[model samples]
Target: MTSEAPLPKPSFMNALITFGLIVVVISYGLFFLKVNLHSLMLICLMIAGISASLLTRCDFSTIRHAMSEGVSRALGAIFVFILIGVLIAAFIQAGTVSALIYYGLQFLTPSMLLPAGLILCSLMSVATGTSWGTAGTAGVVLVGVGGAMNIPLPLVAGVVVSGACFGDKISPLSDTTILAAISSRTDLYDHIRSMMYTTGPAFLIVLLVFWLLGQQYAGNALPSSQLLLMSNALNNAYIINAWCLLPFLVMLGLSIARVAAEPAMLLSSVIAVLIAVFMQDAEIVNVLTALYSGGGPGQTGVAMLDELLGRGGIAAMMWTLSLGLMALSLGGILYKFGFLQVLITTALRRVTSVFNLVVVTILSVFAGNLTMGEAYLSITLGGQLFSDAYDERGVNRSVLSRSLEEGGTLTAPLIPWTTGGAFMSATLGVNVLDYAPWALLNWLNPLLGMLFAFFGIAIFKPQAAPSANHSTPTDVSFKSVN
Candidate 1:
């Protein structure tokens, strides 16, 4: 077996200065100079790569190998991105998205739009196990519908993001969920169950907030005519039927059965394609075209309908894929050179109590998200950095996994340059800052996680005796905090 490289012990100040410089430059370029996110990420990667080499005195080949390893770790996530892109296109062509919108509109009144949007998006995301797909499809359609109702676009976007992320954070099909579980060496379902302690309450609170906000818009007039027009356009464009939902249901069932995400999504995409060909009467050439270009040209004459439905092909995911790869590459470089290990180790040493440890873990993962701008990287590295700490503290790995998701998965969408934030902004037509305040669940999750840690609500301790065969103890005893 190849042995691991020895990590350099750089001063904390040096690591901070290097990371801080990259953040400042990227932030200024993105916010002040209005530079493209992809370009900014590339710039940050260059800065981080150069800094690692300088600080660690590592040669180019060593840095390159580290970067390559990081990219390899992210390969699974990259494939999921590509598959979700194609799956989205298939959903559009199969008329599944249109059917969802059409049916959803019938039940949602203008006054209840916000809460209804949250519920719909949450269900869709949970079912599909993809926040990006939910955002691009149902999330986009809601924006158009909200526009017709004169509802605040930012509020709508916030609700959508909140719901989508909630589902993504906990769902079996979600890449973030799987990544967190694997990184922490915990069972997928166990990780998800542990998260429910925090996620469940946060989601309930967000629902209440949205419902209260909806009451303020209770007197707003519903745009019946515009909605009817869109509905008519949808009916005219494709075959809208219950069968269109079959692919989604099949995917959900597979996820529940613990099938791997890739195969489940692939099967779902195939089902959607078949539906488009036989039920929607789409030409095979048109289906192929949609698979490449997102979706076939919008047949709906309405501009909004055309814009909403005319998205999804494999090409649509290139921007996110590029950003993810670059972010992972930078993460790989940091990990390989021991920059991440040194930084995290420095932070971990200061924790003297369980609460402090949990807090530090949260902050460390948050920092990773800020630095790496990718959920998978943050979760993977956060788990790696804190796994030993949790074991030493007699804490369950589930708690560590939950903390990683709380810090990494929940916060990624709030950073403007991150993959989650960029995709949500691009797909939903709202700036990350504009909708962040309203994405209550995203910010609330971390706070709730901290609260749980402080109060010892769900902080579990290992059984009295360690298992002889297991590397880490599994049975946990729930402890109450003083």
Candidate 2:
């Protein structure tokens, strides 16, 4: 392959100005002007691309090539998002999500609802590996149940958000988890195992906190009539049996075995479709429609039942895909033009120790989430920015992967205008600000990651010589402008 012409170097101030302008526009557009996120992001891409070309005096064709390459890198994640949408629809039609909600509601007493909701949501998110799906389905049901029990809606939303984020952080099927591993060039399973050291403790602490808080509502209970109605509605709408869980079990088993995420999800979705047709007795045409447009509008004549069961499909994912593409395209232009390299190099010069390196990685990833309003961009860009620093310090790439997830994936739900936060807020009917304080896991995971770095706990070091098997550090050559 022929080497491309080197890009002109812009001063740090120029780079800062370009980035600052993009952030201001995005922030103002999203929070103040109420512009659609996709539009704002595309605008940012245009501004950044145009500004980079002018400042560097580079050909626009070169910039376009770089942006295309960047988008290509993220294509895997984009496809997975579509698959998740379809899987969610299939699961709903087959009674997979309904079964989870039905069984979960059975054991939820007011006194134990908070902790139970957290645990159940965590299990569902872990099984499905999609926090959006978990929150949209199980989280919504738990919110209704909590309301009936006289428990605080914000508290219930917090527990649900925390559980969903926690499971998403570690699940092999999760898009964020997969993205982090891919960005850092680490083994996917290895990256997951590394997160447990921090995630395990954070989860336990959240469970305990929720349990203690649940005690205040010990005397409150859902009216028996309401409980009976919900249970009966679910039973009448779909087959609630041990068999409904087979798809989830199969997906989880495949994930554990390191099957590629696409195939695993595809197989599970197909299984769910079969169950929907045979066990649930759903019409083939209706099932197919649900698989494309999501299920609902009262199959069981229960408004609540219809709402809870109606979600997912390839169409459902279009919004996320659009945002993902825009963010990645912007990132691509920035990286291609050397803006990212300049910023990362400037930051690395200040790092004198492993602790500093880890801290910088965390901060950079967090900043990416805040500015980009998307986790995929943060993980991919942050990983590219810091891989060299980690390699230079002899830190394991898995640590970088874990750090990206902690800062980018987990924190996404806490930001009001971010994709994750927006989806959760809309899905759960709780504002991001209202539920953020209670979404303990969303904030705690990052702190735990930094804390581990501070103490060097579970931080693996590279051998004297780099292993041939490990991913090479990303190259960030610094060439001066002519």
Candidate 3:
């Protein structure tokens, strides 16, 4: 139901039937039963367990172990998810988010807002190497601003996701970027450079489209009187100052320095809390409370503004965190029982030519994501599954790495059940289906990558290994769900 289920080592047909039933159940529940993702995931787990019990030869303990192993793979992401919530709360309490909105209103025209937001999210996600952080912080603020500007919420969310993922797909600091390279055994910088051929053009096109889209909203700009009201409310809620932005600047500097994300974010949160206390004169207890559960009904006194600011904190991330765990667990069951391997291996046999190989790799990524519902597993298994195939064809591993992120990282948020999709929906408050069409970069990059394969543009032959690269993957952080 949530991108993973109990697929056992049954024959291919049985595996297909097991998978199909889970999909049908999820579709039925979502389309008619109207169940939440977490609850539906639980049902999926139960269905998988029953399938395994009735269909597979594996025992009960093995099933439990499989699920646990699946969840363990996500520990790094879970750690960051918790930290991002705290960081978001600190930013809000420190008046950093308020100041951004207030200042943005003063300078940015309606026609420029979407483009600006796209660029802003791109920079933050690249700097932080975390799409979740960008979405939770900058994405939240932009949603508020976009709402005030009368832009469609879904469109704003799509732009935020597109930009956030663009950076997550290519940033040197990104875990997905690092993971893709490591998985394909390609040099990190080489992988980054190779992606430029495809991701670069795709992102530029996406930017252009968003710029054009911005023009349509030009006439729907927020009225000066209403803009003044929101700005006044922000001013009244907290002390808006240039100095309040220290946390963000600090985070940016640390990320650029490649000091791992966890410590950098934690340190930035501390700075934000201190600023909130000293500069804004917020109560220590209130600030701490906000850290745990967000500021309730922000003091803006305007319903819309109040709703925008009244977000963040550990509690807000719980739903996303829980869904992520369930997804992992479901993926684990299928993986442990060999369902995923059986199906993917069946598909890999058809790769006879370079173009066929490219198409298969991309489809395998989608297949792995759809089956496991976890991009990390998709990339990992995809790398393991297709590494030799790329070598046999004389293509460089960087291309394989590029394909992995192009599909695994970028499209993760397009699927409603994947953690990336779930996180975007939970954080940005838009359905994945609603934003998928507008998340042009996320979907288009893969097509462009495939186009390169069709023409043999940047796809290079294997190179001799020589130089010592220092950029090893130290932080096995979240899969960009990018």
TM-score to native of every candidate shown: 0.86, 0.80, 0.92
lDDT of each: 0.78, 0.77, 0.82
Highest lDDT among the candidates is held by which one?
Answer: 3
Runs in model 3 lying further than 4 Å from the true structure: 1-9, 54-56, 466-482
Model 1 C-alpha lDDT per residue in residues 1-482, reported as the tens digit of each score: 99976767567777787678878987898779988777887887888778887877878887788778877876766676777778778888888878777776777677788888899889977876778767766787688677656678899999999989988888766777777777887766667878999999999999999999988877775557877787888899888889988877776677556566678778988999999999988888989888878754366877766876777778887877777777778777766665656788988888898889888888888888787667777787888888899999889888999999898888888887666776787667688989999899999989999998999888876545434543331232111100
Query: Which stretches of candidate 1 lie above 4 Å from their native place?
Result: 1-7, 123-141, 172-194, 295-299, 388-397, 426-429, 465-482
Q: Which is better, 1 or 3, measured by lDDT? A: 3
lDDT of 3 by residue, 85-146 (tens): 89888988898888877877788777888898899999888877878878977898888888
Q: Looking at candidate 1, what is the lDDT of residue 401?
A: 92
RMSD of each: 5.0, 5.9, 4.0
Candidate 2 lDDT over 330-427, as tens digits, reads: 77777667665577679889999877787788888777666555677778888888888888888888899999998888888887656677667656
Using TM-score as the yardstick, the better of models 1 and 3 is 3
lDDT of 3 at 260: 75
For model 3, the run of ten residues with the poorest summed lDDT: 473-482
| Model 2 misplaced regions, further than 4 Å | 120-161, 164-197, 216-220, 297-302, 352-355, 371-402, 413-436, 451-482
For candidate 2, what is the TM-score? 0.80
Whole-structure CA lDDT of model 1: 0.78
